[model samples]
Target: MSRTKKDDKPAGWRKAEIIEAAAQCFMERGYHATTVDDVATRLNATKGRIYHHYATKTDLFFDVHRTGMDRLFSAIRPVHDRGGPARERLVAMLLAHARAMLEHHTYETVVAQGVQVHRFDQTTEGQRQTMRDLIATRDTLEQLFKSTLEDAIAEGTLAARDVSIAVKVLLGGLQWSIFWYRPQPGETEADRVALAEKMVAPLVAGLRAAD
Candidate 1:
């Protein structure tokens, strides 16, 4: 049966529900092992609703990946835009990034893993285009980090060095924290923010140009 827009609920709501359900499945079973039916069942919906929004499992998976990455980048986009001293903005960006990751740990995990296995080459032309767009969005987010780092370097708030390498080290350190941070009985977001600040402080200090 052909699925049409009329068959689905509001486009925004349907897409959000499917992405949420798919993220849950992808996180639990990994992307390669997850199926469209898995997401449908998780949401207590049917394949028709899934098809109305996504042409294939690959397409839906791409949506899940994109949504997760967007959430992380959106968390810091405002901080990046709010004009301020590079050092203060950098600190805010790092803390925001860290909080987003810790709060959406499962989604972040799936996104990190999806980057390795979700190849656009495996899909049809249309699907490949969608994947390319998502990849572009991811790259755009990374550029924000790069720009902030460069600004800090130019302002002498960060030490003189390769900005690209510095951005990588910063992201790698922040992302890897997801694997080690466990919420104890009293651990809070503030605790995570403190840890993130501690991690960034030394890197920022070390990067500052000698007076």
Candidate 2:
């Protein structure tokens, strides 16, 4: 017997839908304001489906945040693993990061906003375990950025400033793009690439040693 089209969806599709809906809810309403029912309502599905995949609203939100971080790291992971000139690799990583931010704008927005309102300490021990997992996932991506910056400095592509401070500035600037960057009707990825290159070029130049 042939399966129906709906039944033909890959196993992960349903979970992806739930995460997408939850991300939208968290973005539209603040994290504290959003509930599992809100996500189910947005998805036009029952809460059971979500509960099947996530134990609580916090768990769902944590998955949403993890999804965003995973997208970011997946995009940069190739450049990070590739052997290349440090400057070239750094540029590749920055461009990948910007593209990921644009593609996963909603998830990224929720993550930026939710971190301010959500606290792991409020959760039970099990829930806190989930929170720690999410934080570690986020920190891994951050360490990738830090490692890239350090490599650039070591290669003389960037100056010998504190890697921690440099990573902060780089990530802060990249994250703020989610807030203000509105693409015009005819805007292309090339346009965004050019803009990103322009924004980072001067900073990179400033980091070069005086000769």
Candidate 3:
């Protein structure tokens, strides 16, 4: 069945649908190589269907990148905001991040590439603004981790001379999973949960202060 209609009325699901298709195409073929036709082919729809929502391929790509950042926020922001020791909250946040890496694999994959802004030319004002906003979002997420790390250091749970480097090391480990993690065919959420826990323990312990 057609998820979109011929009428001009907006279906709220249409935009998200297009973004998902675009993410998959970008993930498989890369942003430079993927075309509107490629995304349409993935959706089993026509180019007009995608064009209805997004005027250009760059707009759709940025939307996919934005949606990926949104997913990361949804997964980790609540855990970061809640009351707890900073170490515990950091652990929870890292676990949540790892799970997001596996669960929203394609979107996260696109987002990782989107971080390399120098590769793409943002010629128009709108595209430049979108890149600025996306960079701000990335900084916000990193700051969340930096704040948590600072708390842990102040509390003497974790010791680090440079919080900035620490943040990069921690997040870099989790982010690298999108490259090497090949999910088993029959794996469940439970499996990913276990892997996330296993992956985070050593990372957390490495930063622990001497007794």
Error of 2 at 187 (Å): 6.0
TM-score of each model, in listed order: 0.82, 0.83, 0.91
Q: On a 0 to 100 scale, what is the lDDT of residue 22 in model 1?
A: 90
Clashing pairs in 2: none
lDDT of 3 by residue, 1-211 (tens): 2433434446766777789889999999888889999999998889998888888888898999999999999999999999699989999999999899888899999998886643665547898789889989989999999999999989998877798888889888998998998779999999999998888878877755741
Off by over 4 Å in 2: 1-8, 117-121, 182-195, 206-211
User: Who is ahead in lDDT, 1 or 3?
Assistant: 3
Global Cα RMSD, each model: 4.8, 3.5, 2.7
Instruction: Count clashing residue pairs per candidate.
Output: 3, 0, 0
Query: Which prediction has more favorable TM-score, 2 or 3?
Result: 3
TM-score of candidate 2 on Cα atoms, chains taken together: 0.83
| Pairs of colliding residues, candidate 3 | none
Q: How far in Å is the alpha carbon of 32 misplaced in model 2?
A: 1.4
Per residue, candidate 2 scores C-alpha lDDT tens digits across 156-181 of: 87767787877777767777877787
